[model samples]
Target: MSAGNIRLYSYWRSSAAYRVRIALNLKGLPFETMPVHLLQDGGQQHTPEFNDLNPQELVPVLMHGNRILRQSMSIIEYLDETWPTPPLMPATARERQRVRAIAQMIACDIHPLNNLRVLQFMDKTWNVPQAERDTWTRHWIKVGLDAVEDTLCDNPSTGDFCDGEQPTLADCCLVPQVFNAERFGVDMAPYRTIRRIVQNCLAMDEFKAARPENQPDAPAPGGN
Candidate 1:
């Protein structure tokens, strides 16, 4: 682990890991990726070896030499601090707070109800049918995105990104959530602001390269 060397434990389709990939690419930091197959062999995240890295049994665990970081939001903040040339937070504290709030709307409120384990629990415990599980995921994502669309569309502060003219931590959180929403068949026609912002993000090489489908460990065509 030399200087600037980072190892990220990631799953190709993980929205959290996708966020970190954008942060790393935006900061112009290069890192090695270790694919953690979430569905293979009964979930590698639950294994003892991986558990040593993150007791929470989650992906997007970052290793920088002796130091280990967890949580996509925390890791992105650390990256922004360590590599500040391309600042992720806005200059003013108030703007930064707004940016963080938008980011958390997706990360905390929308995502928790739709994560793999939650869906799995619904299936394994309550015997929820696949169609109903999809409905559950779509409901949360739509509700969350509706609020986010309102905030961004109604606010004067929003620029090409979530806050100001520059890309911030909020954009990093946003694109991935949008991707997940589309995958689950949530209609995007109503979210004009989000669609515009995501279009701007996808135009940049940093964001394009961070897409889940572009990851090395992503499933091949036809879902492998």
Candidate 2:
């Protein structure tokens, strides 16, 4: 509602937070970012103030007017509903469903299993070794990307981007997942379609600006 006062609780490397950033930039909206260091002192998201804002203790809680939106995809949908310029979903019902399915193939099917908290739990609580953790991350990411490649290869609707020539919600979700995959040392040569799509999106200013390394709070080149 309000113009310049929008605030985003974010971590530079967070894939979920990265999705919301891309959506906001695509909508051409101005918002301030509040960096939440997810690893500092056991994660600032767990602090009382942030917990009150979002009990889930996640980065990327968007504050617009009095509304606090949680969950990356939900926030992106809300932005689409509120702003509606360069629509992220297709006009037809079937097309919209297809777009959402592609987006979920990454957001729902891939990201959650390898999120930071999940890995932390596996390492700390379960005592899983680092090699196994890398294996876990790579496994889920590859499975999701394989599904994406199959879906896009079959669906004629898929153009340069996930749904069409223009970047859609699916592209928003896909790019970040690709970034995560690279981070985990996953071999992406198997998913040729996904790799091509990610390359296309990377060339766009909107997606380029939303990259984790491009964020103001991003860690230095090799630093975590």
Candidate 3:
């Protein structure tokens, strides 16, 4: 599909959506943003219009020409395959597996536990308090990040980025998770490698542009 026809339906603070944004920016692809506010109007994602687009009702849906794509990881992989310059996946199979492992550890294991819906469910279904919910969020993030830190630390493949000097799919996943962890009050003092890599990633123009605060739908600094 042509660059002009690329459109992304994204939420400002959704880590999954953030992952796709990072990948698109890193690939230097120009895409239109269709903001879907997760908290407004009881979530625009729950509307019939959006439900038809994605039964899962998640953001970071990509419309490339007439094709519809959901799931941030899948969309990012599609972008990598469709636009190969500055490839996101590594060249070797083993290296690719390592990247995917790290990506999935965050995307599948860490992120899902603390996703908005899951947190909302905990609040509504179980009447979980905000402080308790935050504690819950922090616990899982620490658990997952602890494993990630172990994986990244002392690994030869770990460079300035997660797997190599150049940012890969793993970096796209890591940066957003770190953002969420920080937002939820997870302590970062223990994860030196993650902090180092995240600092390296955020210093880049692409990663900076894709940050949650930079998104059009993001709330103003002092505004709710």
Candidate 4:
């Protein structure tokens, strides 16, 4: 297969988009970024063009040649399968499941509750106050991170990264969730293991480059 043309539809502050960015950076694949301002003009994601691209009207849509891939985890897995030099899934079947489980613990269980659209709906439709909305965000993040901490703490497979010493699907899912936690002022002290993993991943160039504030469209690091 040819090394295909790649394009990424992304929003600067989107954790899901950030996850795909990290995966792309780690794979050392160059791709064009097409910004879809999730909050501008009543969310450009809801526009007819973007909606046609993804009926869900979500960010981080990966266009691999003719294939349009949605869902951050699925996109990353596609990248891993298509270009398998540094594998994201472990060689062992059970260990790969462990990594995927840890990843899904955040992607499926946690992120859906606190996503941009969900929070926006809470604020606009339900009239939730800013403080209450923050509470709502932090509450889910804490719950998810707590479970992640337990998983990492108990699982012997965990190393400096989520699985073994090298970063994997687990770490790709994790760094973005931690970013969301810090954004909402979720106390990191309670999840020491999770914080340690976040710190280790942040030290890497790939994670740093993929951070929300690192994007061209993002506000300065401390601005938000």
TM-scores, each model vs. reference: 0.98, 0.97, 0.98, 0.96
Q: Write the per-residue lDDT of candidate 3 for residues 2-47, one digit (tens) a residue.
A: 5778899998899999999999999999988999989889999999
- In candidate 2, what are the lDDT values of residues 11-129, reduced to their tens digit? 99999999888888888888898999999988999999999999999988999988889998889998899888878878999988998898888889899999989999999999999
* Candidate 4 segments exceeding 4 Å error: 220-224
The collision pairs in model 3 are: none
TM-score of 4: 0.96
In order of TM-score, best first, we have 3, 1, 2, 4
Off by over 4 Å in 3: none
Evaluation by lDDT, superior candidate among 1 and 3: 3
- Residue lDDT tens for model 4, 1-224: 45558999999889899999999988888888899988779889999999989999998899988898999999999989998967878899999889999999999999999998888889889999999988988988888898999999856888898999988988999999988888789889988788888899999998899988778788665663
Candidate 4 lDDT (Cα, 0 to 1): 0.89
Candidate 1, clashing residue pairs? none
- The lDDT-based order of candidates, best leading, equals 3, 1, 4, 2
